[model samples]
Target: TQLLEQSPQFLSIQEGENLTVYCNSSSVFSSLQWYRQEPGEGPVLLVTVVTGGEVKKLKRLTFQFGDARKDSSLHITAAQPGDTGLYLCAGLPSGAGSYQLTFGKGTKLSVIP
Candidate 1:
């Protein structure tokens, strides 16, 4: 079974600051996805990386897939209070046929205004 691990299980920062969070796995993935969830709400898909070494940007946030497709990172610049939430990383194993995904323990971020 493939497992994804995220670092710094929780974080607190002030608005306007920048932070980076990481997701890693021992196995290669066919694709990796990042999601953000707010209290009492389902996680919202932020981005998906399919190609190794690919980088995607969403407003103030940037997502990058490692060259080996075994790791990824999310970077937020000039964070705002609205950015406070739980960040989750999920991955589809390279040869998996089903839609099953391996998820990492989420990182909860609190942005102080």
Candidate 2:
């Protein structure tokens, strides 16, 4: 099974801060997806980088795929209270039609206002 793990598991900071979250694995994936979710809502796709070494940015958020497609990272610059949410990365392994994502436990970000 393809596995993805996240570091820190949780983060807390005052408004107007900076932070980075990481996702790593020992296996290569066909595609990688980054999503941010509010407590009761489904994850919203931030970006999907299919090729290795791909980098995409959304507003103050940046997403990168590892050279070997075995890892990814999400960085939020100058985080705001609105950035508070659960951040997750989903890696699609080979032979997956519906590659149900193996999700990282989650990085619960709390931006204190």
> What TM-score goes with each of the models?
0.97, 0.93
* Minimal lDDT window, size 10, model 1: 94-103
Clashing pairs in 1: none
**Per-residue lDDT for 98 in model 1?**
50
Q: In terms of TM-score, which candidate is strongest?
A: 1
Which digits, one per residue and each the tens of the lDDT, describe model 1 over residues 1-113? 89899988999999999999999989999999999999999999999999999999999999999999999999999999999999999999988375788889999999999
Kindly report which residue stretches of model 1 are placed more than 4 angstroms away from their true locations once superposed: 96-98
lDDT score, candidate 2, position 50: 92
What is the TM-score of candidate 1?
0.97
- The candidate scoring highest on lDDT is 1
Number of clashes recorded per candidate: 0, 0
